[model samples]
Target: MIRARQLKDWLPITKKEIEMRGWNEVDVIIVSGDAYVDHPSYGTAVIGRIIESEGFKVAIIPQPNWKDDLRDFKKFGRPKYFFGVTAGCMDSMVNHYTANKRLRSNDSYTPGGEAGFRPDYATVVYTKILKELYPDVPVLIGGIEASLRRVTHYDYWQDKLLPTILEDAPADLLVYGMGEQPLRDILKAVKSGVPLSEIREVRQVAYMAPHVPESPDWNTVELASHEDCLNDKLKYAANFKIVEVESNKWQANRIIQKVGQRTLVINPPYKIMTEEEMDASFDLPYTRMPHPKYSKRGPIPSYEMIKFSINMHRGCFGGCSFCTISAHQGKFIASRSEQSILKEVDELVAHPEFKGYISDLGGPSANMYRMKGKDESICNRCQAPSCIHPVICSNLDTSHKPLTEIYRKVDAHPGVKKAFVGSGIRYDLLVDDFNKNNQDGNHDEYMEQLVTRHVSGRLKVAPEHTSDATLRVMRKPSFKYFHKFKEKYDKIQEKHSLKQPLIPYFISSHPGCEEADMAHLAAETKDMGFRLEQVQDFTPTPMTVAEVIYYTGVHPYTLQPVKTAKSPEEKQVQNRYFFWYKPEVRNWIRNRLTKLGEKDLANKLVGNTYSHSGNTPKQHKKNKSKRR
Candidate 1:
């Protein structure tokens, strides 16, 4: 038995540190692709801390040198219980390469934000290395990479349907989703002397077996076989539809897909964490700082950005086709109690580095803290991926009072001078025209509170695209809703005499979006006095409906053909529209729009006619009207 160390600031990493803690053997050794950051926002730290809280001896090996003589894998020898492998917070391929398949020069998760610290497919690499060194030790993989790739899915980098990570890595188990509940269950089963091989009943876990196990308790849903998907794109598309629906359901059934001779079984996920459970997870002792070892190497950019931020909930019901938050975090909101949130705020106030400011008090969506389905039975029976998309669900409680109250409580902190909602707000929720059945009828109050108190200088919201056709494909509401939201936002700003900018974020080159659509977006936003400083070219990541459409050229739900900018040139041309004001791109935009027979759009975007003040005459008049 390993003697437990008195709770240390961070988990032990080196053998010397392990020995100093009086641990001859650790129950779990976590191997990660990211540099160690002992903050709750970082997954490795959270998981390591949770395991330590369970009274198990846990140590971490972060950014292990996979190219070396395998010393990192052998340094800890074999953990007594299991080795947890993760590709850090992001998928490894996404971390290593750009959407255009070009290698990135920096990784924000690293100590110095440098790239190439970890290998491509870091989860598979680390787990395979561990298994090669210690075949007897159990290896379990988790994190964003494993969670999104837990089933047969399209790999954008590889441009093929890859089997689940379980088939690729020689791991005994794979944990998916938020991981806290499933991890606790795994720890309990393992502590009870259940062999890792036989721990198949744990929820949110996946493993391979020679044949499907007979479990009378579970109702299993088999997906398209890996062979069938490989042979036919339609089968592959159809399979994703099943996987996505099962994933978002409240009471999901077990999912099984055959891969060659073995059967891949994914146990249903744990129910959404209750308020108490969410509070408990956040209340776990966290230093909320990067491990001291990275002091000289420079700060992890990702950690620095959110060190002072507080996550109020876990899950996004928006279910944007391009986003994986719902798939990984779940569709329901698991919010922290107000007390728990206030306690965290108080702790931030006491931190030596704190400067009378709480960076952010938000989650996946800032205003979704306490929002949920008004009727529990309706939500349980519902399989819709988004509660707000297409239209806000009638059963969803779109009230923002609870969120506003939380903001008020945080702002009331004597030590906190300001608490900003850095996360993007679902503007549709606050628009009366968009959310017609808002039960609380406090949309104006919520918007007023957010704009006057919570916003630091600018409030950010994602309109994504202006085209209703593309917006529908993206699972986002119509752009008209955004216009209504902006009208309300501008009215509030004028009423309060505040000059806070309502920044809207947009995406270019998303699935089903054409260059013509992007040009229209650029023209419309420009007409509305937006130069579009916040914009991104859509990069298809794994396990998103957008990615499925991008790779397969078909919508997963309807099996209809969808157009995507596949080539670098196609994507670049679409992205150029976002920067029509730039001199270098002005001619390029004019020529492209002209070539596409969109002369009017080109004139709107980059017409020669302009006022001496460098503003178009029409734009000047529109800006003047806004001042009135």
Candidate 2:
């Protein structure tokens, strides 16, 4: 690891830093909505470092003052190639507001966790400023905000469908997904004297043109135009299904959409990165900390949270409907080699702030490391969005031995006391009932290893919802599988005499979920002795099945109507079910359930009966039955 001991080590964030590097002009000046953190986890740092690795002078203007006289956009002057803009690691709207559409007071990506560091639509704001200042200079947009919004989709915060970000941002080019492969290709082409607008054939890129460009190499799929989607919501829903399937394919078709008179062409993404390539990306010269400029302001909450953690992989195959992992990272699991992961572990242990503990050795889904199709040819032709949903794909190799081996190797590090899997696990993969492919008992071995060694106090898993109908819409397994997994988990804990609790995450007000379902979830979980602490109200974001349903009132896959709680009152009623244990909400729950004619469930959840031991009603009943 190349530690940053001086300002010169980091990529130039100011004009003086550029002068310090003896550069009159940079090849690329990246404008980001996040504070400068030279960590591998941060997208701005990754993109900046990648540009530097390619022997280009790159500087980042992070969290530039949009309200000011636009000094930050002009700090490094116009780049030789183009300006790369991103709304940081998160989509700006999601970062700025809660699910309830309330303005958030803390920005985790900002120094001191203060709000108002960046505008609402940060990428659009930054790109517009750059374009206004230098109309001749080309602008490139990427990162989560751009990648997910590359096509016309729903914007929950705005409560309306917005066209491709290109329509508003007016960037010359957009690099979607992880951006490394596309960025490299674009840079090399620019170095070869090709203009950004002329470099059209690169994979994982989107651009606007008067008409669709013909490519013999890739078959093209024209989506419903933005105007058509606006006129017909079902057409919009159908468009989403196409976008989702194409996004997950190993060999995908180039996507074309009509935004207006101009056509938006989105070339297919690059294939899954090889182990060596994945290693190279993670093995970049990152300082693994925020820039020194923020030393007095206060620590960035997001950076601090992942400072000591090691990401083992890049993608998830679970493909939960509500998640954006597959949408941005793709469904294929591109995992680092063991050497790369262990090297990161070594760096983490050596960091000054590390306390002999590694915060996480995980990715989008912790247990999905190094998993893929058993048949390469099968994966190439498959278009299914999820690998282990509905039923675990017969072609999938669900072995846990590789991950277990890596965990053991990580534990063997002399300086490391514990390396926890902080990322949420796909718990269904562990249940033998759900995953029958674990013939060698590797799941048991891995579970024992994780519970015995990795967990700090609790391990988090997302069952998502309890109702089967809701789980189906969410692309999750039934709650019965959760019960089976919990039983096995309890057995393992009992056998080891360990007390670590299993924290299951759930969502309220999701599409297909009703107040009654939430009540049942409350009663069932209360019976399981859990007052759920990790619950969330479903917030529809762009390019997800749930979000599409929320806007269109129909399942994108089935094109059938599905009820979603949209009103604040409906959402609040669904949410209150999760807090039935609170004395203040018990009466409210009783009244609501009584109105729903679910008096039995209401009594099960917030009954008048109480015990001195403070056990739940069901548990108290069990104790009474034992006495009898």
Top-TM-score structure, candidate number: 2
Q: Residues 1-628, candidate 1, lDDT per residue (tens digit)?
A: 1132233667888888888888889899999999888777889988998898888999999998998667887787778899999999999998888767889999999988988899999999998888888888899899999999988888888888899888899999999999999999899888989977779888889999999898787899999899998899888888888888998887889999999999999888888999988887889887777777778998799988898899999899999999989989999999999899888888788777789877788898988888899899999899898898788898998778888888888888889899998999988888788899665668788888989988889999998999999999999889998989988888888998999898999988999899999999999999899988888888888789998898889999999999999888999888888987776777777778889998888887888533434456688788779989
Clashes of each: 0, 0
Query: How well does model 2 score by local distance difference test?
Result: 0.91
Best model number under lDDT: 2
Give the per-residue Cα lDDT of candidate 2 at 249. Answer: 90
Give the TM-score of each candidate: 0.95, 0.96
Off by over 4 Å in 2: 1-4, 609-628
> What lDDT score is found at residue 477 in candidate 2?
96
lDDT of each: 0.87, 0.91
Error of 2 at 34 (Å): 0.6
